[model samples]
Target: MGKSGQFIKRWKSLSYDGKVIFLKSAVCLLLIKTGLTLLPFLQFRRLFHRITETSTVKEVSPQQIELTVWAVDTAANLLPFELLCLPRALAAKYLLRKVPSLTLEIGIEVNPAKHFEAHAWVENNGTVIMGKWPESVSYHRLWAWK
Candidate 1:
């Protein structure tokens, strides 16, 4: 069977709640991508903050949160445009329960030739929830936000 057929089959195998979560992830990814593309940096950040703030956070297991994050990350990666770490992290934060202590972190590294480089990632209880945390070790942490 073709990839599209396989995808449909796989999608059909998920439970109703899983499907809903996946759909939400896809929509959030599209919105984040579009907002980043069309709005100024501060405006996009404000909009993103408002959306996340307004989402209803429910009680969910750690494993369920992990699954949601993985699904959202996968969907975000498949988008046509470059989806950066901040949006992906925000999407995970939006889907997770409000009490898990997840943090969005930004780091920077000074390169002798290239001036500097920056990276963003999310962490939960010191464990990396998303982005390249292992690779981020070379970067000096600049700031973090809840």
Candidate 2:
């Protein structure tokens, strides 16, 4: 069939728990997007911190959570609006409550011609989980949140 039909079939194939996780990720994305639009940067950070702190910790494997986040992000990124790194990293962090080994890292790069740019990514056990770049060496790590 067509792409929409394929997507519907794939979504229908997921277990109930998987569907719940996907919905949670979607909510996280919406919250982050709205916070960025309606609140100051610090205020958005506070909101994110509060949500993450209050979220229930599920007993799931780090790899499983990472995969779920990846799937959600992939689907979300298909939208017309830019989803960016921050929302993706935040969603991954929110889903990986029990797996504290994974951390969210922000990095920056400066180019004389192109100006400055920043990126956020998730990592577990030193391996990049999301937002990996082929030229990772070009960016200087700014800070990380665990």
Candidate 3:
């Protein structure tokens, strides 16, 4: 919790115009890697691989599911797969829902030494609305509130 807290503490919010400028810049950008164009199907592949490796039934928490849904809703008006996560950030800021501030750490196997690691997810009150910076999924974090 300590490290993640510090990372977030150093972050400043994007101003309204800054946010708008960011949005404009994002419009012409690619959200995920081109390889991830198949990500929707890859979720199943990831599920099977995880099951084969650890035998888990796709363990997305209620908070994760809710936020994913919210992300989908918020991204609908935007690019195809480009803005799926932005809505979750906005929702976390003003969704007015009760959710826990949870930190998540998941490791992907492509480049385990450097690429494979953990991520920090943060929820507000009880709902997961945002995540740690850079989405590196490797950094350790601090205690988040619910």
Candidate 4:
């Protein structure tokens, strides 16, 4: 597995302007997300593989957690109308590729009463980035990592 400290260090090396460029130019993220949702995952990963590499961070594969955060933040800035649905499955799959034997559980639920269903995410390693526990709530899970 890649060293966490090393990953963090690499992530920290980006310049302020460089980060803004990637975030602004991440125009294809919406296409990637939608295409992946429709097409075969491996094919989509091929598209995503490009995205994982399209950052200012050097010496790091597209699979690092920091890279993902970078990419997501950038896309959020660019994709104003996009659903930050949080790309949960994509993140999990990325972790699965990078970290071996990573098993995550997503307790997914939706409530139509509130107009949108909510999804609960939990990593097998017990990381609760989205601990809203939305399993019983009604909010559409745009995409989440469990």
Candidate 5:
């Protein structure tokens, strides 16, 4: 089977809620990617904050968080263009906006090769919900937003 056919099969295998989550992740990724291109960082963040703000805070299960991570990761992979860590973090934040414990974190590191790198991730109640990798522990946390 072709890549398109495999993609369709994988997509069709998802349950209804999974499908919804995937769609949300894909849309959020597109919006954040575009927003980052067109707007200043601060302005785009403020707009994103306003858009994702929720009146009521709710607690969600670990499984829900896992599902969200899966959705975001899967959506990012399926996109024709790359969606970097910052956009992925922002997208997860949008999905988990109602969760009061959610936080967006940025970390930086200077590699042995003398290259500076940065990463973004989201955490809920002190546990990383997205953007974690084996090297993630090496990064020094620069900032976080709740």
Candidate 6:
């Protein structure tokens, strides 16, 4: 079958909960992508903080965390525009807002070309749930939010 058929088949194969998570992730990613384009960094940070604050703290299972990561990554892949690591990480944070142990970290590194690069990732209980890079260890963590 063609790509569209494959996509439809994949969509049909997902469980109801999986489908919900995927849809939520897609919308969250799209919003974050657009927000990043229109808002200043500080203003967006405040908006994100307000959004996350609405969720009551609750203990989250590892399976739930994994599902959140999978949904965000899959949705990011299917999106028409490319999503950078920050937006993906932010989307994961939004999905995992109820987890008190959730942490969002920003890191920086100097590339071989002497260009400074930044990366963002979400971690739960010290384990990275999104934005894991091949040279993840090389990036110096600049900030972390819990």
RMSD vs true structure, all candidates: 3.1, 2.8, 18.1, 10.1, 2.3, 2.4
Candidate 3: 10-residue stretch with minimal lDDT:
91-100
> Per-residue alpha-carbon lDDT of model 2 for 51-142, expressed as tens digits?
66743445677557765775658556655577888878877887775675678899887555666889898887788888787763466789
Candidate 3 overall lDDT versus native: 0.38
Model 2 CA deviation exceeding 4 Å by range: 1-6, 54-59, 110-113
Kindly provide the TM-score of model 4 when superposed on the true structure, using C-alpha atoms: 0.40
- Backbone clash total for model 1 is 0
Which candidate should be chosen as best, given lDDT against the real structure?
Answer: 5
* Candidate 3 TM-score, true structure as reference: 0.25
Instruction: Give lDDT: candidate 1, residue 69.
Output: 81
Query: Can you give the lDDT of residue 118 in candidate 6?
Result: 91
Error at 66, model 3, angstroms: 3.8
Model 4 spans with C-alpha error above 4 angstroms: 1-28, 36-64, 86-92, 101-105, 109-116, 120-124, 130-146
What lDDT is reached at residue 109 by model 3?
28
RMSD of 4: 10.1
Candidate 2 local Cα displacement, residue 141, angstroms: 0.7
Report the C-alpha lDDT of model 6 over 1-146, residue by residue, as the tens digit.
97558667877988898789889999999999999999999999999988888547788778778878988987898899999899999999998889888899998875576588899999877877798877534778999976
What lDDT tens digits, residue by residue, belong to model 1 across residues 50-138?
76664444567777777688678767766677777877877777676374477778888655666677877888877887886555347
**RMSD in angstroms, candidate 1?**
3.1
> Per-residue lDDT of 1-146 in model 5, one digit per residue for the tens?
98668768868888898789889999999989999999999999899989988898888788888888888988898899989899999999999889999999999874676578899999888888798868534877899978
- Comparison by TM-score, 2 against 6, better one: 6
Sort by lDDT, best first: what order?
Answer: 5, 6, 2, 1, 4, 3
- The per-prediction tally of clashing pairs is 0, 0, 12, 10, 0, 0
